[model samples]
Target: MCYYLKLKYFTLHGPLPGMPPQFLLGNLAQSGLLFDKASLPEAHIAFKQRYGDIYQFWISSTRLIVVNNLNDIQHIFTHRNIYDQGDIYVQKFSIVIPHGLISSKGAKYKRHAGLTLPLFRRGKIVSNFDLIVDCVDKLLIRWRTKSPQHVHLDIVQQSQNLLLAIFGLIGFDYDMETLDNDNDTNKNELTKALQYFLSNFNIMLFSPKILSTIYFKLSSQYRQSQKTIEQYFDRMIKQELDNGKELIAQRKRTSLIASLVGSLQQDEEMETNKSEEDRKGLSRNELLDEMRLFLLAGFETTSTALAWFIHLMSKHPQVQQNIKTELSNNNSQGLLSLDRLDSLVYLDCVIKEVFRFCPPINGTVRTLTVDDRLPETGAQLFRGDQILIPFHSLARDTRYWSIDPELFYPERFLGADKDHHPYALIPFGGGHRQCIGQDLARFELKVIAARLMQYVTFGDGGNQVNSGGHLSKLTIIPKHVGVTIDFDK
Candidate 1:
């Protein structure tokens, strides 16, 4: 029956323009095999060779159109109404993240985005700069202790800790200080939850929710850990509410949640002048869900990006040294102030290059709300078509980037020539729905990378980090990224 269904689906679509579709399973098996172990860039290049620039593939009954060109990405993102985040992965993300920006869509997403945008404004991000620097300082101190030895540092753990500290300051006004105090329960629990989420990516993909529920019931530790995260947030929210009146009166610290609660309180006060429906604010459950989304979204992507940056730097010694030299000239004290870090041009290039090289979110899946045709290829796509824009592939495409696309060249982003195709390097994405925390992420990466370079020199640890393969998860991550950090001076 399954075989017959596969044949029927492929037979209906006779190679819709760019490339021919396979008789059975379409190009799904081939695409899956390429992505199974190779990096996103390699997979994209391989597919482009076999199935033109844009190709269609089917995984069982689901059909996907992979787009590797900048023009195509612009078309999809700009025509926001036409393309929405529609994928099985997004559905799964909703299960864990609830109604956060990453999972939410349409008017609901827009409204929430409106309410939350102010919290991540430049002024607000600048206010949180000190907290970011403090986190980086703590990380450097740890690296200093392991001086002169090849420290088998888990880049992933370090990145997670850094982001946790940043998010704690911004979200709950809590200083995690996980880097300094390894035994912090709040830090440990959050870390465990994230790690567990990543580790069980495949299970979440294949296992049905009912089966997952049964498995969670059987696994006492998973149940306990999940409960810990829920209880922690619940207590934190309650405590904030309890202190809400006093907090508003004093206006001591500025947190995203505080900003939100403050805004809602003001709306309530002005309720008499507004319509009944307009006066309604986010419910307690809604607030908690939003908080969960902010925490996970803010931390995971930034941490993952940093891990890749460190791994890449270790591979390219010349680029690492250039960053080190640039840092020395700017901040001789090795203290990374946000202002000083911003002045390091070479360091900024390195971060941008790393992002371009290995985008944390490799590709985003969008579904066409209405029928549309590509301007360049004139390929017609119907409503409900799933489009995969491989950001990793576009960044490295030889057609776009004239240099050896595979090589890690920070100079590609340096002065004068900084204006490459805008859509070409879309690590944070493009259009209205670009990453809200991009500036914050950039700040965190700059400070962390600069401070680390100041204190240590990362050397190749015999084996290359396996930063590829098919992880049944939201983000593309390194399978087992091992690095050796050597302390300097």
Candidate 2:
């Protein structure tokens, strides 16, 4: 690979460092290095050894520049017009969520972002505080059955179930009613549908185009799973349209339904084709797309983050006790107030450290919309070239850290890494492409972590059981998240 004369892309500008395209099988054979769909964080680490920080590789017919450099990543994100969301990603996600935030771009992306932004803002999240607490309390009541003695829990799996149920009751007014069940198979019908989708999501999204095409052709199961998501989404959208107001009457607070309807009403893209009287904000498919975005993304990423927080807390009992102490010292009158949560500075640090330590999302992709050169490297980027900004690399990179970035130490957030590069610890990404539901995700995680600390102690399940290695699919999930719950009496 060091031999420039032997390099296939030597003529292409930029640093040409990486395994020499595997010669015959190309980067496809070394796909594990390019991007490990099964275990991305470690794979990215390995790629750093072979490819260095920024390098080029071939994924089937596509040319990709995988970068972990903070400046290059920030440039791609900040210059939105020059680098757009990869259309391949849009195409892949559109299979399940058409015109949704992940699938749509330009005007459609703005429309979705604008309507949902206010719904997840800090104020709106505060309003939903009680509902989130109620959800966690339900889990606590069930955990009471296993109190006094420690019971092993697959906390990652459990958090997924819990967050799904909470989203149902809060966002869509549908009760999952799965909290009482001991069996994974015994779930609400809608929950079951989601489980089916999760179980059979397209692994093809990460594969080479040739391999993915072959996989898609052979599997009707993948298509069926997509249909399952669409069917569940459309039904929910209809139910919200018909009885959303009545459902929210029980809460007396605004439901996310209003945003869906508002977007639906103001959507006038098809107005020129339809009569002046028949303009609609979102078509039926568009409404379903937004619902898919809210439901899937709303629950899954947060649950993974919370799961990582718990897994890390179990390993660091001293840190956990500090959070408990902070909770006690800050506890006062109006239960579950954001002010109270804000007072727990240590808990906030632990949360940031958890995000830094185990970011659920591996990274994101963008396509160069025009030919350009990177600021520092002067690398040539042709229009439509792909850029993979590895989130795990940036978070774990030692260059930007005053404290050792490798440790699970939260105090780094308080002292040494206080002025760390803004782009370094971004688990949710940045600029125009940032996740819209971050405020709500943080709110849910904080209240839930506080409630758990108040009610139970997450005992470390030892090195074998609590061993942390990520199982990277779409999200970087803990490979083994076993923890023993010691219920607080």
TM-score of every model? 0.84, 0.87
Model 2 segments beyond 4 Å from truth?
1-15, 21-38, 57-62, 147-153, 208-235, 244-254, 262-280, 330-335
lDDT of 2 by residue, 1-489 (tens): 446533643333455676555433346556563343436667667778776878875543445688877777778888988998876677566655657778877666666566567667787677767788888888887777764455455677679888987887677776666686864456655566665666544354555445655665667765665576667666666776676555534433356765575445444465547753444456656777777778888888989998898889888999988888877773654255667877878888888898889998878788888997887655778897888877888888999899888899988878989899998988887877778888788878888898788777888787887887887555778888778888765
Candidate 2, lDDT over the whole model: 0.73
Candidate 1 per-residue lDDT over residues 305-399, each given as its tens digit: 88888778767889889978887884556666767866898888888888887888866678888899987777788887888777887877777
Q: Give the clash count for model 1.
A: 0
Q: Write down the lDDT of every candidate, Cα atoms only.
A: 0.69, 0.73
Candidate 1, which segments miss by more than 4 Å at Cα?
A: 1-14, 17-42, 58-61, 87-90, 182-187, 205-223, 246-254, 260-279, 330-335, 415-417, 464-473
Highest TM-score against the true fold, candidate: 2
Q: Which candidate is the best by lDDT?
A: 2
